[model samples]
Target: MHNEGKTKMIPFGDLSREYDDLSIEIDNTVAGLLKSGWFVLGKKVEEFEEVFADFIGKEVFAVGVGSGTEALHLALVASGVTHGDYVITVPNTAVPTVSAISFSGATPLFVDIDPDTYNIDTNKLRELVVIEKKRRGNKLKALIPVHLYGQSADMEPVLAIAREFNLTVIEDACQAHGAEYKGKRVGSFGDYACFSFYPSKNLGAYGDGGMITTKTPEQAHTLKMLRNYGQEKRYYHTIKGFNSRLDELQAAILLTKIKYLDTWNTRRRDIADFYNQNIKNKAITKPVEVSYGKHVFHLYVIRHPERDRLQAYLQNNDVQTVIHYPLSIHLQEAYKDLGYSQGDFPVAEKVAEEILSLPIFPQLRDKEAETVAELINSFS
Candidate 1:
């Protein structure tokens, strides 16, 4: 029995309509880039970096890079994470977080996430550092706390642990563009913070783009060199580096998107509130937003005991949903050599099985959200 008015399909994330919503503005921005005929790292990239640095605050310098992976890679390299160094991060994040560690000629040491926040478990991090020191003997050099699902990781303790252990803090803020921690931004708290401008990100560009925010001018300078073949001066090649420059076109597009980032993030928070207030199904657990910081809600994730069945039910009702990650990174085939097993990260493993990402974006209509909530409540 389909409802007559709410039958239209709702996508998990509709990038097409987003483009259509800002078609004219996006077209003009792209057109400007085409007319200028300057495509590489130029004025557009520089301007966006300046503006983005300002947005991050704390006088942090932002270095534009080719992608989020590259941003992490450069941040690690700049922080002196060389061959055989150990970098600690959560196993519940995107592969790129661990891959960047590998790319920096370092090994990734996995930590479990907090069940409530889905970010790095600070208590586990504190305990692990002590154990890891005994097992590996001071090889650990960094901690990359991912601000997962737009909520800040518990940074006070994480940073305190980092300070005590002498580890660099590289924030994986790819999903938390405007997220905060105790009235401060996530990127400002770390030694270096990496952001991804993937098409579906809270502050996405027209195409792939990324930025690394750093507090020190030296770190910023080092990142700039690393992203462009290690050359501060043309043909200088001071050190071996990658050709990972963020292009002008993407920068131009991001400049446009940055203008709307706060507004979009606010809308996302509003949608999350709607879902939180209305969805009363006991079988499903809604996402939690801690009071310590402002959550931007990049992906409105929920957990259900029968996640697969609920997803199927939503699909049948023409309301699309997705899983943020179905497999924990440590359990993935790519990291089988890391010597992890099924029960190693029990919390992350359990979350992977039950977590489902509901349709959430700035453009999601109130009626659509209501319809989705109604369908979810109707589930047996």
Candidate 2:
């Protein structure tokens, strides 16, 4: 139990304790890697990819790359999204989501999100794809459905729509490491699934890392070639590519970390469950878990009309919180040329205003979570 009389500073996220918990094992694994004198796309990366592929199931091929952004870019290139083509994805995502589209030589087209789930609204997506295809004549080449906030998007209809429109589907499972839809893993649902292992992710590496999952052999081969200067064999360039290979160091750390992903995700759910059962203030809206999928609660976001005030209050109460996103990608200064205005995505824009990311890492104490809820309940 927390002593309400004694206040302490609670961080939005604290990775130090997580590291302390794994210090011995991580140190040992890292020491072994440093001694091996083999880094940069070596045996460790190959081993990690095989293990990860099995983890995702269905004989899926996993190719490790430099970062999640690179995973998206490589997947888009493998799926044939070239210059002048448009890639469809929701705008209420990390800027890297759109940046990856630009990197692949495709214009990013925005779609609004389902307010309840905070994932792309598949119905609106279908309508937009159909309308855009008619108006633009097949410039829409791919769909990147982000499994936002550790929840799987309702993928069935999205997949059906993709098939109907002959568009390649890329699952942006960057935040949803082990999330499931209809008892199937998220990365398995699309033609290419991209994952990020940044330090803050559910399955994070100490540094930037990513993986691309696909069922097709040719696509996997192409991704491998594309991530390593277009060379399948050393000094033998097959095509123009980028030097975006995942290094052996991150791979070794990830190999150690992946074993605990499920356990951590389960702990995250337990914390989310605690939050859901408590925190009944009418001023705030709690996140909803869709019936079709499991939400891993990457960020236990809640909404308050006075989100900024609530955050201020929490900060003064010795708790730190952040907005998962303060601004939607379309409205950001970088995408000004995309010609998007404030009213374009009403749900996303509203979410951007109200969302507050409470600290919910696996290492967070139950007492800490209770304190956070108690502060919110006590807020005027």
lDDT of 2 by residue, 1-380 (tens): 77777677888889998999999999999999999999998999999999999888866999999999999999999888999999999989888989999988899999999999899999999999999888777788999999999999999999999999899999999999999999988899899999999999999999899999999888899999999999989999999999898999999999999999999999999999999999988888999998889999998999999999999999988999988799999899999999999999999999999999999999999899999999999998
Count clashing pairs, candidate 2. 0
lDDT of 1: 0.92
| Residue 322 in candidate 1, Cα distance off native in Å | 1.0
10 residues in a row with least lDDT, candidate 1? 131-140
Q: How high is the CA lDDT of each candidate model?
A: 0.92, 0.93
Q: Which is the leading candidate under lDDT?
A: 2
Q: Rate residue 251 of model 2 by lDDT.
A: 97
Residue lDDT tens for model 1, 1-380: 77788668998888887788888988999999999999999999999999999898957999999989999999999988899889999999988999999989899999999998899989899999999877777688999999998999999999999889888999999999989999988799999999999999999977788999999888888898999999989999987788899999999999987999999999999999999999998898998889899999999999998999999999998999988899999899999999999999999999999999999999888999999999999998
Candidate 2's TM-score: 0.97
TM-score of 1: 0.97
**Pairs with steric clashes in candidate 1:** none
